[model samples]
Target: MSHATTSIAAEQDGPADIALSEFFDGHPVATFAIDTAHVVTHWNRACEQLLGWTKADMVGTANHWQAFYPRPRPLLADVIIAGAAGLESELERLYPGKHRRSALIPDAYEVEEFFPNIGASGHWLHFTAAPLRDGNGRVVGAIETLRDVTERRVAENALRRAHDNLEHVVDKRTGQLADINAKLQEDIAQRLLAEAELRRSNLELTELNQQLSRAQQQLLQADKLASIGQLAAGVAHEINNPIGYIFSNFRTLQNYLDQLFGMLDAYQRAEPSLAAPDAATLRALRERIDLDFLRQDIPTLMAESGEGIVRVRHIVQDLKDFSRVDANQEWVWADLHRGIDSTLNIVSNEVKYKADVVKEYGAIPDIQCLPLQINQVVMNLIVNAAHAIGDERGRITVRTGRDGDDHVWLEIGDNGSGIAPETVSRIFDPFFTTKAIGKGTGLGLSLAYGIVQKHSGRIDVDTALGQGTRFRVRLPIRHGAATEDPTA
Candidate 1:
């Protein structure tokens, strides 16, 4: 369909085709219509806009297959036209079960399939095709409409990955959970037996209320444990990737060591032998073994392996510091910058792939606080920033500075999608998440809020939709409560 030919056809088309063309041109979705002979009668403006084929190139032609496929195969629209004429048996062989009859429409079919030749690469389309009939109720042709559903497909895949990760962690912890359950049952049995003691009757009422309180605490702790279980898997993976290569390098070094040792043994034996091998034989051995390459590479390989071990150890230490594994949970004078650094290291795996982290540090005084708990708050903020950025390359800027003489402040900002104004207030509310299921526990900000509050600090949010978000945490330079309550 050349441009000049389409212009002539538009001028000669019947009133009915003109009216249909008018309707399809302004339609909201990508649409096209063809006549009984499979010749394209109308290619809408939206069709041209979406499929990159101008009306001049598509109208008055039956080459619709070129827009979607490499060869002339019957499209879903063709299937609809054929099926409407009772050619169901052949369509079965043509398309198999790749498409389905539209449950909501009569004599229509819908399909969600990948169009490999569309756009820059492949694109997923959600489209439906229906027979276009005339006043006498005969099939005149077929009209097809479609839209790109690639973003929805991406979200579905992320949800699936999240679900799989959660399931994997649950399966790995099944044994630990079973052991805990067995021990819990034994504890209950022993306590019940102890309740039968003659002196226990006096405190039974108090014990019941206490047990109820403990049950609530246990539930709270269970959530914490679940969070920990999830973190453990990610941390394990972060450690494992480097360790895997490190161990592999070391194994290769071991083989190299054996080879070198064998060469050394040969040299030692030759030195004591009355009839040592001639120079050519030794030269051949060295060349066959590639001694020159080994001399240069062995140290380099060992050095790289050593660096890998250092990396693994540093990550392990950061995890320990972030989790307060071996440190007291008491409030103390702590370096805020160091705390932030450790927290960033702890969640490095989470952020590294999502965005580039930029640290903007300034001079600030150490504050009296629960350092590890503060690190937890920092981790939550950093992770939230990472997740808020959609699946595109983004940047997160972390800044630390002084706020007057009494307070110090830190900011975590992202140049990704920001929060909506209406939902900003409710963001701190527990269990309110914008993320899809299985990706968040929704306790991140809530926990961060509580932790900051305990430190007598406040979290202020600055955000604009589609621009970005920055969360600022301001704490007093020092607190007087350090001596009053050690745990605080």
Candidate 2:
């Protein structure tokens, strides 16, 4: 009803009704009331503000549904007036899942729904309606309250969408991580296989290297024996010449001694028999014995014998130096020239027959090396030089010098037929030779090359046809020293 009609009804009901009307108008909630006939009885100030229809226009009219819906329909208050018999079914029909019984008020129902005509866009509102009954418990009218919940509903929907998007992102990332883990596992497996294969190859290579080392040592021993045999034969021949002459001298000396003793015995017998010592007999004996000649020749024989002994001693000393028989293959500082000289002595028999040795020694420092091995290098080069000479007598030049400050070098050159171009390349290869079988084992140059390499040195050959060949060996002054082109 309008305010004037409400005032008129209040006047009829007395002061208590007036207080009730004032209370309804002053309430904060947007509320409206309906009569038993479904006519609008009261529209509070809050309801007028919410629906944009003043109490002056809505009170006493049955058009309250116009505020929330597009056409005339029962409001929540009308639904309550339909009575409790089919109340739940009626609420289910109107609001579906949005309606429920009020938790705080008996015989009251609540619903939250969107009303398109309630605002500029729309509004979500939660509204509750309860019955107003008479003293006899008969339904007389109903009161409805509304609350705007648009902002809360919008925020809840945004949060739900965010939660769904987060779930999708987490699932996608988990799948990607699984794929990466599989790839990494496969890579590890492949790497393990590769490592195992590499280890097997290394073990095989180590065994092969050990076998090759044994073979190389055997070859070296064989070469040394061959060279020794050749040296022994030559040394015997050289020593025999001196020994034969010395033996002949000893026989002659014995004869001279016997004749002298016979003459002395006769003199002694005559001295005892004759007063004048028989001078003529003595003279005859002296003339027969050739005393003056014996005197001169005996001293000469002794000198020659001593010289032969000295030669023998020197040969033995040279052999000792060349072989280093007492040495334990240790690195030591030694005179390269001294080693070269001893090597020359040992191999002299090989070279002397075919070549005249010319020594060109230079002032050089001692070097650190395995002395016996160095001697082997010199021996090999000299032997090779001797072999290079042809039928005609040749000159073998042995040269030694310092190369800069860090290295020393020795060159053995022969004035024989030079090495062939094809033969030069394989000269240092084991068992490769130009000599006839039984003459050369061909390990001389190869062993020499290996020794020089072990000393961190180098060997180079220079040759021209008929002009002869020169083999130069350069060695570091200090054992294990870094190597460079010393000639450069």
Candidate 3:
């Protein structure tokens, strides 16, 4: 025992070695020592905090294994004092591959393991143990230090799972993309025959559109209505032939698709009787393309496309109807509601972002006046209402009602910045405008005023600053001689 004096055994002596005991107890790392007999000699303050076992209970007992394991077993420090012959055998039975020789300490061993009995929830511990030698270099005891590495272990496991999941997703997507690329190559080869014809058609259409644009620019110098009329008429005449063939081709495509789907159905029914390799190949292709979903979605897509083409046709027709004021100025019986709707459709781009439009129409008879001129009047009023709106979103309301039996009235109003009294008096004067430069020509209200007068009608305005403005046009049921300008 005299050889144990210079080792950790010095701390086990009575009051004479109190300073040595205090020094070992003051260490920050969880540490404990065991003699050659496997008896606990020291347990530090950090070890007490780590396992909730006081130094008094642990310092003189061999029950240290109780803090880490359910049943008593030799801990790393106990194994370290067993001499080299028994040390390797004991570690192989307990720690196995988790033990490794410490890189920084000669003949010291380090191990990491999950100790289920360490706390309420288990903890992962990394501990190192080394033999304590006397002056003659004979092993008399062993000292072990411990660290809790539970958090690091948890993070490592999570990162491993995430990496594995990402690799699986990448492999699945790669297989799917390879299959689709093969199918796409086959489709592209078959469609190459039609690509040349489609390109030729596109080139012809582009040249025709350029010619029409030049014609439209020349006509714009004549007047607004004339330019619109020329463009609409030219587009309708030139584009309708192409649209007609396109619509017809869609029908032809539908028929071809029906025949192809019929052939595919027949092939599917005969698949079970085919050779094993052929059946497997067919099944793989169908899985790659998700053929069942495409079978359900293709008809829906075709129907939507057909509806879009029909809507385009109606839009072109509306354009022609809207621009007929200068093309045909004849007075004709027409539905005022229809005219208003067409006018709104033409100017929708101006008002959609600025304000929401609400229409309240009353049942009224057809008016015998120029349809295009009335549409023009409605467009001008609606455009003015939209321009009066400030930065915030606003509302524009259009109302129509029969004004007795011989006349009908149309009112367009907005929740916007109202016209000033001074400016209101001159709003209908040609070239008179309070608008910013390039935003207005100021002829819109003037043209509307003259058109109303031509139909022997009257235009009235009601407005207030910061509230809103309303313009009402009252027109005769039938066209008549020119009337005196009462509001002039």
Candidate 4:
């Protein structure tokens, strides 16, 4: 009914503008709004519940920052207002990092900042704000929504510190090994001590490496689950579109059936008439109910309902195939194109908003590998490609084909902001990212690297600042067939 009634109402009586524009309470996210004067005008229940400040205390005041700041610093909404009013330099002076325009929301800005007074130590708040416009299209105020991502931030920091420790070990052990070699050639007495130290270092390195691997894999799994949770909303919306129309169609069909049954009862009652039911009576009944229109529209409604069902089914299957819900990550000969297509479908929401995806697929044979793991790699590449493109209209080209007789290659290329030359080397390094806090875990490409390595393959990047970046993932036609290729 929502689908049908909305369209019908739209066609009959176009939408009306309302003056009471602020709807903070209706928003699912914790939200608050302020007027052009920077006075809080709308403070929602969620906001009050999250921030321990009620609407009565907030609404009509400019003391919003005191809730989350030590000395009333400008919040994300204030930064957006400053930027809108051409005070962008003030934004730079205030928030040097951790704040920027959100790629997901137009004309809105997002910031991830920690406020120590919010929780035990601090809570990382990810918030987005956009200028609110009145019915006359006048800039009235700005509204912001907030969410706490404290656990993820804590885990990320721990992982970063762990990575630093691992790096320190590498540096220390390299120097120790070089010294041990020099000393073993010169001094025989300390050889035992040096060998024992080397053994201890090796054991420590192994342990630290194991810890790093586990942290990275856990991060990858967490990221994957987060992706799925995000995808669930998009999938539900996609399914709802068809279901809504199908329901409307069914209602119309039910009405048609009622009218048809009424006409049949009329004919039966009039059967006992003098001339076996006068044609005029039945014709009048048909005309009253617009029987001719029903005859023309009923078949269309049924056909359209069938199409809607098929669409819903296809979306469901795509979700299942992308997740590999019942399938294990086992090696099998699979069509790489199929996996790419399914992964693309699953992440369509992420890309459709940022860039237009272009597939330049070539003839490729079935490759023997873990399909689900490869799909995960493809998903990460495509999502990263979309994010790289940012909010502007851009293109993401995915190309695939044989890389020689021994390897099959897949490349995801984006015509967006390219990576810096210096940053390219660390793009695949664990815990290294250019994304803002709460936006990435920095383990996506590293996980992809590990997956490729496990398949006896390699992932290489070609990037130039301002010219775009292309990630090429090449896998052996048969797993372990590439001689001397390292595995993770």
What's each prediction's TM-score? 0.47, 0.48, 0.52, 0.51
Residue-pair clashes per prediction, in order, are: 0, 2, 0, 0
Query: Please, what are the lDDT tens digits per residue for candidate 1 over residues 350-440?
Result: 9999999999999998898877668877888999999888889899999999988888889999988999889888887768898889988
Give the distance in Å from residue 42's predicted Cα in candidate 1 to where it truly belongs: 44
| Minimal lDDT window, size 10, model 1 | 479-488
lDDT of 4 by residue, 289-358 (tens): 8977876787687778777677776777666566653345567888899889988998899888888889
Model 2 regions more than 4 Å off: 1-211, 222-277, 483-488
Error of 4 at 46 (Å): 45
> Compared with the true structure, what per-residue lDDT tens digits does model 2 show for residues 46-160?
9988888888888778888889888888889999987878888888888888888899999998999988898799989999999987679877789999998999998988999
Best by lDDT: 3
Give me candidate 2's TM-score against the actual structure.
0.48
lDDT of 1 at 193: 76
For model 1, the stretches where C-alpha displacement exceeds 4 angstroms are: 1-276, 481-488
Q: Pick the candidate with the highest TM-score.
A: 3
> What value of lDDT does candidate 2 attain over all alpha carbons?
0.82
Global CA lDDT computed for model 4 = 0.78
lDDT against the true structure, each candidate: 0.78, 0.82, 0.84, 0.78
Task: Tell me the tens digit of each residue's lDDT in model 3 across 118-206.
Answer: 88888999999999887899887899999999999999999999999999999999999999999988899667868888899999999
Q: In model 1, what lDDT does residue 229 have?
A: 40
